[model samples]
Target: MIKLLIADDSALMRKLLQDIFVAEGDFDIRLARNGAEALDLVRSFDPQVITLDVQMPDMDGLTCLSQIMIEMPRPVVMVSSLTAEGAEETLEAIELGAVDFVAKPSGAVSLEIDRLRPVLVEKVRAASKARIRRTLRLTERVRHQMRSAVTARVRPKPARRRPVSGAGKPKQKPGPSALPGLVLIGSSTGGPAALDAVLPSLPGDFPWPVLVAQHLPASFTGPFARRLNSECQLSVVEVGNPMPLQAGTIYIARGDADVVVAARATGIIAMPAPARASYLWHPSVERMVLSALECIDAERMLGVMLTGMGNDGAAAMKKLSEGGGRTIAEAESTAVVWGMPGELVKNGGAGLVRPVDDIAEAIVELVGAHASH
Candidate 1:
């Protein structure tokens, strides 16, 4: 059984969350009234997965989450409201090491909470599979430091990472003309922070139009793009209404539906994800890759898979590789879940595997040669 903990200030909310998980019948659940209680229970219950409220009286969720990560690294999913403030705090929580988040339903005591049940259950299961890393966690002090740097538009010096074995660095160097015609990426679980890390590394004038598909809720994707645009060199936009593609700007797939790329007389058009294209995750990675491949010859394409929970993009990435595209996957050492990229590696889909920190530099050097032109 998955040992689970539900921490919230509201008694009703706590009970509602617990009942949602209890129906799963595979979790041993524990409840805490606030951050302080959550901390207390952590020592005793030792939950495999934790659901945290973004706001809790006495001790807020963010503070408690940092402490949990620093003291004992386990999977955490934020249970936040659907408001704007809730979205911002939840994104911060993800960057801080919480696996993922689910928004609270419409009202105080509405049965609408049941709508979030699948999301809650899936996030917990994914968290249970996380590597449970506890080393060099971002303390509250570091978070403040990073924020101060962001406000000044000055990039903070990132923490140093030690190299791990088995992850093969790119064997072939990116020559002067090694840049691809297009770049496609897909991720889930730990993707928000991973994208934050990668996008900032490229130059403001990157050549190819980078398209990305991530498993995220519709409410969060727009805010995520806005947040990324503030910190990264490249401009980020969420695909909502149909528009032609452009280089130097990153287009993120809409979380509400699939984003299909099609070749049109006017360059490329972004299409709404059709119901006919059934998939496990919204903005499915495989569907994106397949569509791109059908519409464009991928000989000069590049596919990169970041930290995520499943094999949504593996097969398509493999086909991309076979069809003569450069492909890379985040090494297991840095991936939070490693499911998507790991599947690629196992199937010999990735030509290169590097740590999360190195992916951007690799892209900059590999695609930069062409992107700069």
Candidate 2:
């Protein structure tokens, strides 16, 4: 049985979560009324995984999480509200080493939480198996502290910018000479922190336009894109509508839907589409890769599978490799959950396997070589 500790300020929420896990028949559970109680139990109970509620009394989830990570690091999943402020807090928790999160239904005393049973159980199970990298967390902690001050004073507001062509669609096709190589990235679970490590490493003048499909709820993607934009040299924007793809910019696929790339008459465009019944994960990586392949030649593409909990991109990336595209899988040592990338490596899809820190360097080398040839 998985040893699990659940911390929440609300008694109802604590019991609701406990009942969900108890029904699984595979978890040994403990409950904490707040972050302080949770911290106490972390030592006495020594649980394998923890589920933290963000708005706990006495000590908030963020403060408690920082201590737990520093004192006795373990896998944690934050139970967050589905609000903009909650999204920001959850992302901060992830950067401080939380493995994953489940957004609680909006409102107090929500029976709607029943809808999240599968997601909560699945993420907690995944968290139990996740690795905690102290070095990475410490490095992020310092940098996050530095950025916090600057960001608080002048944080960028999230907004939807008009696409290049004032029209809803591209008007005129740019010539083949305007086409640039594309890098497609798919991630989940430990994705945000992994993306933070990799994207910022690319230089300001990096050649290809990068696209990322990360599993998230609709409320979270805009803040996530803005957060990355502040940290990285390249501009980062959420693909809310059809936007022309350009080098030196990173497009984060909008959440709660699939974002696909299509060759428009004007140029290449990235746009959000309805989530297809065929794809299991939102912001579906599989759908994105297949869609891009339909328009862009595999030779002009690159597929990257980072730390995530499932085989979302494995098959399509394998096809990309077979069609002459390059692919990279995050090494087992660095991936908090190696499911996605591990599947790629196991299936002979990965052209290279590198730890998270080295991925940017590999991309630079490979893309530069492709550019030269």
Candidate 3:
């Protein structure tokens, strides 16, 4: 059975969540009223997963999270209000190693409770099996430290210029019916929402195979892919080793593996990292982009970086831009947390920065233009 601990100051919230999991009949649930209580349970119970609320009288979720990671690391799902401040703190918690989060329900207890059931259950299950990484805020001091460490460890590569062939270039072609060469996407913190906005826009007849690397946990990817497949026009599935790439399909990397496109005669194959090779976080955006750049021609690749935290994709996006791929970043106004895409823009790695809605349209336009050519 999956062992779970629910930490929240609100009795109603705790009871509501407990009921949801109990109904599922697959979980062993524990309860904690505050962060301190939760920490104590964690040491003794050693639960497989934890759902920690943002606000608690004894200790805040962030403090508890730090202690949890330092003492005994496990998957944690932060529970927060839907306010702007809540969102900010929730993102911070993620950076501190929380796997995912669920927004606290609002309005009438009955109405809100029902609305949150599905998301809560899903997040709980995902958190139970997620691989969490060590995270630090991307402050100037932290960046300086990282830069120094990187500089001391490795030599910098020569600067490369962004390719301009596709810029303002009209789509011309042998015919209007050719298939898409490749589809590359990057996503971070708010990637799920961004993807929800974009993936469904592609028609069922889309000719390109889609590749996505979302910064998420292993447990989340499977359910996430399934959810996308249900909503999207195309078939969406979590990628596994030796899976053949096909048009009208979306492949999400497993949460514990790097998603890479491997070259093949018919098309690219989805390559997942071996278990031993898995990073603390899987579906690494950087590794995915670099591998895609090496496997496919730039002109044939469509690279997109969506809302996220951190600069994980910035360096690889530079390669994509230089390789003549069409690279796009999520615009700041629409991002949940602008850290990742912002870094790409600051580094001049993005060819275009567009809002979430426009991203889908832009992709279609680019693909259409490529087909025409």
Candidate 4:
């Protein structure tokens, strides 16, 4: 049985969560009413995975999370609200070494709690297997805190470049039918921090437009894009409407929907479409890659699979490789959960396998070389 800890200030929430997990029959669970109690249980219970509520009284969730990461360094899943403030706090929790988060339905005690049961159980199970690299977590926490200290007052710059037309596109393509090479990225679970490592490393003048399909909630994606924009040299925007895909931009797929590219008379554009029941994960990587393939030739595309819980992008990327596209899978050495990228590697899809820190450089080298030819 997996040893689990549940931390929340609300007696109702604690009891509901306990009941949900208790029904599962696989977890030997303990509950704490506040962060202070949670911290104590961390030492005494030594749980394998923890579900931490961000709004806890007495030592708040973020403070407790920091201490836990510094001292114990185990996988933690944050339980957060769906509001904007909740989004910001959840992002910070990821930076502080929490593996993933589940957004609570609106209201203090929601009727939607029952609806959250499946997702909650699934994320906790995934967290149990996640790798918590203490060195990497500590390094990122320090770096992020220092950066946050300096940027506390300044607002993130708005995305400046407008969509580019086909006429304005570079002349490096093989034919009129082929578009400039695109970098398609897919990630989940530990993706936020993994992306923090890669996207900020690329120069502002990166040659290709990058599209990222990260599994997130709608409220969180906007904040996530803004956060990435603040940190990255490249402009980042969440795809909420049909926007022209331009070079040097990173477009994040809106949460709760899938982002797909289509050929416009003027240029390629990305738009958020209704989530398809066929794909299990929202902002589905499999669907995104398949959609892009319909318009862009395989050789002119690159597929990057990052740390995620499931094999969403593997099959589609395998198809991309079989058609001559370049692919990179994050190495197990650096992945918090190696499920997505590991499937890509196992099935002979990846052209290169790299650690999280090395992925940005590899992308620059490969895409830059292709554009030069």
Candidate 5:
């Protein structure tokens, strides 16, 4: 049975969540009246997943999260009110190692409870299985110290061109049947499972380089990449500084960094920014798509918007479409949350709407068809 600890100050909210989970019939539930009680239960009960309310009487959820993550790490889903401050704090909770969350509904208990059931169940499942990592603040100082030590031990090398793969083969003008130069994909929320379904279907020697941005907590992205690499045929690695893009390899953006694909004379540059502040979401899909557009012209680029909550990628997909690039948005039935890709389709940004299973094949065919012209 999945063990869950529901911590909230409001008795009704806690009871509602418990009812939702219990109705699902697969959970062992524990309730905490406040953050302090939750902490005590976390120590004794050792629950696999925790749902914490942001505002609490004794200790706030953020403080509880900091302590829990440091002492005994586990997946935490922040139960936040649907207020601006609540949203901001919930985002912070995500940054601080909470896996994900659901916005608490207001008014009409029956209706709100019904509306939240699906999201709550899904998030609880994802959180239960998520591999929780150490909070970034605790590790940042150590990481900084380690970085300084490493920098002192190593010497910078001169910039050299990375050789393009499969270059030695005789130039065969890729007839309209060849794949494009690069494939750029952006996703959030339910992206990992979607990508897992889509990526492994492509052949091992897939012709185009694949770049992806999956909105995720920094702590989760490393494990997420490992999980994808284990399941997929293609070699997947978390994109780091100065990593050169290579065909047949998939580069996943590390959380907390904006992933931008820049073209160079030798090969593609995987540009990562450590402190990008302008965008609301790190690894912003808009930034990634715009950068890809700069590197590969629209016709040679393929943009994909997958399931997510917000409209982060919609604007950029529009730019890509206007630039003559083909864009695909995940269909509603296939999406866990239809907010992101749904916006793209509604706004006329997407050139095609396809199921998750057909995305890779569609890209291959679309690029191949273009190459033949």
Candidate 6:
């Protein structure tokens, strides 16, 4: 039996979680009513996977998570609310080494959390397979990747030369706008924190716009974009409707649907995801990449597959690559779950494999080369 721990402040919530997992029939469930109890049980139960609630009395989930990672790093799946604060903290948990998160379906005390039963079970299963690393080792690897990226050759800025005036004077102005085309990136599971590592590395003058479609709930995506915008130099916004694409901006798809790119005589436009049964992830990575191929030439686009569960973008990325598109897969060394990118690499879709911190450099190289042509 797979040893599992369920920790929450509410007795009702603990029993509720227990009942849900009990139905799965493969887990040996243990319960903790508070963080202190969870800490004690960590040694007694030695759970293989832990489902930890975000808010708890005495010691909160974040604090408990920090301690857990330090003393006994094990796979953790956060139970978070579908609210701004919850999303923010959940992302932090991922950065802290949690395998993934589950959105606690709308209610403080309602049984509606049961609505997440299917996803919760699957995530727990996935979490069990996660490789738990010590905090020091993980941090060092991330720093190394970032350092390597900075030292690597990347996108070249357009030459800036002053224009000669009527006489002998010269006038200075901002550099020319970034080249045409788009960069599409997709991820799930560990995506939030991975995105934070990558996006901030791309400068404000990054050539071509970026389109992102991560697996997120409607309530979380908006706040996620806002949070990303605060950290990254690029202007980030949550896509609401069809809008003209512009340079140096990153548009994140609405959580409930896909964001598709369509070519118009005027320019490229972003629209809501169309209904497609083939997709499993909400803002389906495959659907978005395929739709983007219609507007941006495959040879000019860069398709990046980041950490996530399943092969959401693998087939489409392979297709994109066959048509001369540049592709990258997040390296397993850094991936929280390498399923998506691992599939892509297995299918020969990616030309390069990089860690999350090094992806911005890869993007710059591909886009800059494409632009120079």
lDDT of each: 0.78, 0.87, 0.73, 0.87, 0.74, 0.79
Better of 3 and 4 by lDDT: 4
Local lDDT at 216 for model 4: 97
> Which runs of model 4 end up more than 4 angstroms from their true locations?
107-110, 135-179
Error of 3 at 121 (Å): 24
Model 4 agreement with the true structure over 87-113: per-residue lDDT tens digits: 998998897889999987675465888
Please, what are the lDDT tens digits per residue for candidate 5 over residues 299-363?
87788888776788799888889988889998887775677899999999999999886777787
- Candidate 3, residue 285: Cα displacement in angstroms equals 1.1
What does candidate 3's lDDT look like per residue over 74-185, in tens digits?
Answer: 8788888766567556645654567678777667765788888976786677557554433222232223333544675342332212212233222112223333587888
- Candidate 2 lDDT trough over 10 residues, lowest sum: 163-172
The runs of at least 3 residues in candidate 3 whose Cα sits more than 4 Å from the true structure, single-residue gaps closed, are 1-179, 275-281
Top candidate on TM-score is 2
In model 3, which range of ten residues has the least summed lDDT? 157-166
Which has the better TM-score: candidate 2, or candidate 3? 2
My TM-score estimates for the predictions, one after another, are 0.83, 0.91, 0.56, 0.90, 0.57, 0.83
Residue 29 error for model 1, in Å? 3.0
For TM-score, candidate 2 versus 4, the one ahead is: 2
Q: Which pairs of residues collide in candidate 3? A: 172-372, 172-373, 173-372, 173-373, 189-308
lDDT of 6 by residue, 58-168 (tens): 988977887787678889999998787798778667766787888876765456765778888989998888765442254543343334437652322222212111121
Cα RMSD, each candidate: 6.0, 6.1, 16.6, 5.2, 13.0, 8.2
For candidate 5, give the lDDT of residue 94. Answer: 57
Q: Using alpha carbons, what is the TM-score of model 6?
A: 0.83
